[model samples]
Target chain A: MSSVLRFRDLTLGYDRHPAVHHLAGEIERGALLAVCGPNGAGKSTLLKGIAGVLRPIGGRIERMGCEPRQIAYLPQAADIDRSFPISVFDMVAMGHWRSMGLFGGLGQARKLKVFDAIAAVGLTGFEDRSIGTLSGGQMQRMLFARLLLQDAPVILLDEPFTAIDARTMADLVDIVKRWHGENRTVIAVLHDFEMVREHFPQTLLLAREKVAWGDTRETLSAENLLRARRIVEAFDREALECTRAA
Target chain B: MYDYLIAPFSEFEFMRRALVGSIALSLAGAPVGVFLMLRRMSLTGDAMAHAILPGAAIGYLLAGLSLGAMTAGGLIAGVLVALAAGAVARFTALREDASLAAFYLISLALGVTIVSLRGSNVDLLHLLFGSVLALDEATLLLLAVISTATLVIFAALYRPLVLETLDPGYLASVSGAGAPTQLVFLCLVVLNLVGGFHALGTLMAVGLMMLPAASARLWAEDVTAAIAIAMGMGVVASYAGLVLSYHAGVPSGPVIILVCGAFYILSLFFGRASGLIRLFSGRQHLEA
Candidate 1:
């Protein structure tokens, strides 16, 4: 089979101005790609472009041979407004909305899908829990549950583990490995170098441009490493190193 | 007191008109009120309600035709102001509440000017204050038609509306569900204002529409349950308002508003979310 996603000379932005420029790449079917960059280096922009949220300004995005409903997204947990009074079940069930009629008259079949998704995310007893009651890790898992119900072969995740604790990161890595085992295509934006080295086989290092991209071993060059840490050099490193050691 | 309560519905057709029309308006106002709370567009309801004054006067100028004509004119005008306010809020740096307030003030002034231009000083007072007891058969029919149509449309567009109201940004970008949500919601608000104009008057229409639904939120944990309870409370307020107005011979609109206000007070004391009961109970747990 051909690559599941193709980005050729791609440019994307909101409001007719390009946020990301001239990105050319392709993802083999079932590839696990990690996109790493400093904040506002257009990492989210690239994700949005691929997901069809922001229109690509310059080039074509050929997402070959996948139905619209066959794409799932796990956005940052903070992105969801918690003040809304929807329960965990309510949020998970929404992934089936495209199949549900416009009015969402729920049926036995769709409900089974939602239950299966919740089980897959390991939130077996949280079906009736309010979103406000969830801890950060639980919220992340709930988002995965929603995406699981989508039953898509491709998943785009934006900062799926940031701000959450280390346990959350481990839980998320476990989920990613599960997806990898299933041979599903996974694209995630991250900031951790350790996890990229440990789990993901491919990495895309970015700095408002594609600095380097290849297998993890190829991308760990001293030049790429220096470029990734360049933004942190302006700060005092003495106390920072001490703090890191502690 | 007994005679006043029993005799109105017992004998007078005008009294029956007022009571029947009030029931329809309150029932219809519930769903629109629930959405306004969720969307944080409560102030838009306020702006549209008052903005119809000049249109009501223009409606009065064309008033010789029928109640239907007058109401249609007012609905078109209310929707125009709501759209203008909505567009400016979305497209500019101005806060939506401030934009709504500006529209409301300007529309209120213009409505007064139109009434002066029509130059019927006494009739203008009746429009502002309302005379529910003076309603006729035709006005009641218009209320019925508007209320029924508004409720039906709300039931049809329920989920997308709730989804967009809770999270417009994601719905707009990733999902593109915001467009349909905005259209259905504002349209329903205008429909309620049109029906409400007959009984509560423009000055008080939104107060009746909002106060009960707002209070209902403190007690509800989900959208579906909130709507059901709000509709029931709204119908109860309608019945109670008419009964009190008959026995007390007071203004029907204000009586209904006062009853709804009382419900708000009760909710603040006993409702679940932020009620005083929750506060004291929480304090007890902390101390323990």
Candidate 2:
């Protein structure tokens, strides 16, 4: 299969301190890949780098055959503002932003699509409810509905299943599988190894850098997981900037 | 009741002028205030109100209290201060609120100093507290034009503005509209403040913007409804405050703000959404 995303010695960080450092790999089109790592191992940072929300401190990420907007990104739930007064239907309608654009109206067809997506996520009765009143699982389902409307060639989900119930997680995993079946590239940052091993075909294990990559089972081996934990524990708090050249 | 409530506006030209001017300010400023509160920038909006004073004061200094000059000066000053504060927050260790607070405090002091240099305490008080009853035809037209422009721009920018407020990071990842939407929103805030200061003064202009918005937030569940409620509250408060002030022989600006304050207090206690009464009512939970 052709490569969709290539990380060429990419480094992502805040305040010149690299959170994700010196790793190189390619994500093939239609690949279901999980980025697994310990806390502070920069899974979210890497996802942010790919989403173009955060700039790389070193090297670059190359996207092939798609514009930036053609990639759908769902950040961690904590990044969302639950208190903002927006209804579920309107929030879900934002997925059509790619097609309808800034000034375009939500016509009959688009409204139907929004409703269909909401129904797909099993949020039919909750359409008019304010997003602030939604439980955690319902919020995730709503976000997934928006992702359905996005209909992008590539999708990046950051910690999508955290704080979610089992039923909701299963439903969302099915949606991710559905995207993969449709030949869309899906990259997710996940902590649950059991889910990753069972569902994901490929995995990139990181501990501020790559530990292992390729087949999910092999990448998430006990030795590699232990090594990742050690590497994170050994990370220097006051280390100077990396002298290594990309 | 007619004589006490309606006669002052119907019989006196100045009272009518004050009512009309405040209504325009309410219509424009309330929606902007709703967005500001949503973005949690109510304090920033208040700071921006004060930031306009130095500009208006300089205009008064140069042109001797010309409406056009003061309005233009306030707009420029407010925009500059906003840009400077934003830049400082982005580039330096200082936060946006701290930077904004610093800029506004300096602006307020400079404005008072500038006004006092040429004009007496009476002129300073007029600029600070506003003289709504004395609005000229030009000022009234300015308020009308501002209200019209604000409504049109709001209608056009509504979608992106809501997305930007609700999910800025998501909006950034999806489109390039985030920066421009934020910039336009800031300009709207400054524009409304400039328009408001013409009648409500710099000190009290933010009252017309924020109090009604806060009161509406307690009552409305959705943003559009909140904005509509806030706008209605502002207009009502303006009309009521004008008549009350006329009868009480008091200043119109402070009375208008006081009326808005009263609405906020009443909403705090009795509004349907998230009010004290609802919390204390102790209704049992519905079955799932």
Candidate 3:
């Protein structure tokens, strides 16, 4: 399969301290990859690097055939302020930002698409409800509705299922499967192993460094999981610089 | 009854000017205030208001209370402080709020010192409290022009501003609209504060912006609705305050702000959006 994303010795961090250090990998076109890691394992940072929010400090992130706007990034729920005065329809409609540009109107066809996405998420009656009024699970579902409207070739999700209920998870997992069926590249930063095993065919286990990659079953083996945990635990917080060879 | 309400504005030219000035301020300042409150930057707005003082004071020293000089000074000062605070937050470990507070506190001290150098206590009071009832044609024109510019700029920037405030990360991911949107929004804030200073003075200018916005947030579910409600509340407050000041023989700026305060208190209980009354009733319903 052709690669959609290529990370060549990529290092992402804050204040020169690399959270994701010397990471090297490729996410293939039409692949569903789950990035699993412990706390501070740079899963989200890696996603941010691919999403073009965090620039790499050491190496390059090459998007093989996709433009930057063709990537959809769903940041963690905590990064969003739900109390802002925005309705569900408006938030979902933001997915059309790329096509609409800055000042494009929501014509009839686009409005229908928004309503359809909302209904698909089982939030059909919540078109007018403010985002703050929704429950955590409902909010996640609404975010998935937004992702649906994005219809991007590359989808990046950071802890998308955290704090959501099981039913919402199932519904969203179905949406992820649908995206895969539609030949989109999906990379998700996830902590739940069972969900990853069941849903994602590809897995990249990281502990500030690559521990394992490829098939989900082999990559998520007990040994690889143990090694990842140990490497993350023994990591020196005060390390002056990364000494690994490029 | 009509005479009591109408005479203050109709009979006297100053009252009429005050009415026009405050209404202009409400139309522009209230919408900016809505964004400030939405961004949770109400205190930052307050800080920026104070930050403009030194520049206005310097203007006062240079041109002896000339409206153009002071307005220009206040705009420059407010924008500089905002940019400096933003830079400090961006480059340093200190957060934006801390940096803003630091800048504004220093600005307030400098302003007080500058005003004290040659001006009398009465001059200082006028500078701080403003002469809303005594606005000349030039100041009225400035307010009107500013209000028109604010509305036009807001129309052009409406979508990007909304997206930037709601989900900056998402907006940044899609396009490079975040920084420009923020810069324009801050400029809007500074402009409105400058306009507010002409009528309400530096100390109370943010009150005109923040209070009505806060009250409107409790009542409206959408941004446009909230901004509209905020502007409406501001105009009503200005009119009521003007009438009250004319009869009760009190300062107009403080009276307008107090009227805004009353609206805030009323909304706290009665507003449909997360007001205390609604919260309590919703909890009761859930329990039942």
Candidate 4:
């Protein structure tokens, strides 16, 4: 399969303290990749780097055809303000922003697409409800609906299922599988290894840097998992930078 | 009842001018205020109001209270302070509110010094508290124009503005609308405060903007309804305050703000959305 995203010695961090350091890989097109790591292993940071929200401290990220903005991204639910007085329909309709520009109205065709997306997420009757009133599962469903409307070639989800109920998780996983089936490259930062092993075919295990990258089964082997855990647990705040260069 | 409520506006031209100026302020300021409150920038709005004082004072000093000079001066000063504070917050360790507080404090001192240098206490009072009852034709015209411009811009940028307010990070990730939208919204805030300063003065201008907005939050469930309710509250406060001030010999600006405060207090207790009473009374449990 052809690669859609290439990360060449990418080092991403905040305040010059590298959280994701000297990573290198290519994400193949139509790959369902699950990025698994312990807490603070730069999993979310890596996704942010790929999504173009965080600038790399070193090296480069190369996308095949589309611009970084064209990639559909769903940040953590905590990043969104749930108390804003917006309805589900209006919130979901914002997914049409790429085609609509700033001032375009949701005409008949786009409106129908929005309705279809909402219904696909099983939130058909909750269109008029305020987002602030939505439970955690319902809110996640709404976000998935918006993601459906985004319809990008590459999608990045940063901990999309955190705090979501099991039913909602199952439904959202189906949508993710549907995207993979449509030949869209999807990279997700996930914690649930059981779900990852069951669904994702490709795996990238990271602990601040690449521990292993390959097929899900071998990459998630007991040895690799133990190595990743040791690398994270033994991380030193005052350690010198690695002299190894890619 | 007619003589008490409606006679003063019909009988006196100053009352009429104050009423018109205030209504224009309500029309624009309310929606802006609602957005501000939603963004949790009500304090920033207050700071920007104070930040305009030095500019208006400088204008007063330069041209001796000409409406055009003061308005221009206030706009330039307010925008400068806002940009300065914003830049400081973005590129430095200081938070936005901290930088804003520092800038507005210095600005207030500079404004008070400038005004006190060339004018009497009455002039100072007029600048600080405004002379809404004495609005001239030019000032009234300026208020109308500002209100009209504010409404048009708000409508045009409504979608992006809502998205920006709701999920700024998402908006940033999706499109290039975040920074420009934020900048334009700040400019609108400064503009409304500058316009409001003509009738409500520097200190009380933000009251006209934020109080009605805070009250509206309790009563409305969505942005559109919140903005409408905020505007309605502001207009009512303006009219009632003017009538009360005319009869009670009180200042109209503070009275107008007090009326807004009254609405806020009432809404806190009895509003339908999430009022104190509603929280206490509770609704029936919904079936799964």
Candidate 4 segments whose C-alpha is farther than 4 A from its true place: A239-246, B91-93, B282-288
lDDT per residue as tens, model 3, A1-246: 899899899999898888888888788899999999899889999988888888899998999888776899998754677888789999999999889986789999999999999999999999999898898899889989999999899999999999888889999999999999999999999999999999999999999899999999999999999999998888776887668788
lDDT of 2 by residue, B64-179 (tens): 88998999999999999999999999999999999999999999999999999999998999889889999999999999999999999998898889988888877888899889
* Pairwise TM-score winner, candidates 1 and 4: 4
The TM-scores that each candidate's chain B achieves against the reference are 0.91, 0.98, 0.97, 0.98
lDDT of 4 by residue, A24-142 (tens): 98999999999998898999899888889899989999999989899999886546778999889989998998999877879999999999999999999999999988988898899
Top of the candidates by lDDT: 2
lDDT of 4 by residue, B193-247 (tens): 9998988899998988999999999999999999999999999999999999899
Encode model 3's per-residue lDDT on B174-242: one tens digit a residue. 889789889988998999898888888889988888999999999998999999999999999999999
Q: How would you encode candidate 1's per-residue C-alpha lDDT over A1-246 as one tens digit per residue? A: 579988887777555544565778888889899998777567888877677766777776888777433567665543566877789998888777656747666788888888888887778889998888898788888888777766678888988988778876786688788888898999999888788888999998866557788998688667886785574343332432112110
Candidates in order have lDDT scores of 0.77, 0.93, 0.91, 0.92
Q: Which candidate number would show the highest DockQ if scored against the true structure? A: 4
Whole-structure CA lDDT of model 1: 0.77
Calculate DockQ per candidate and list them: 0.34, 0.68, 0.66, 0.69
Pick out the ten consecutive residues of candidate 2 chain B with the lowest summed lDDT.
B165-174
Model 2 misplacement above 4 A: A237-246
Clashes of 2: 0
Candidate 4, B37: how far from true, in Å?
0.4
lDDT of 3: 0.91
Interface RMSD of each: 3.0, 1.4, 1.3, 1.2
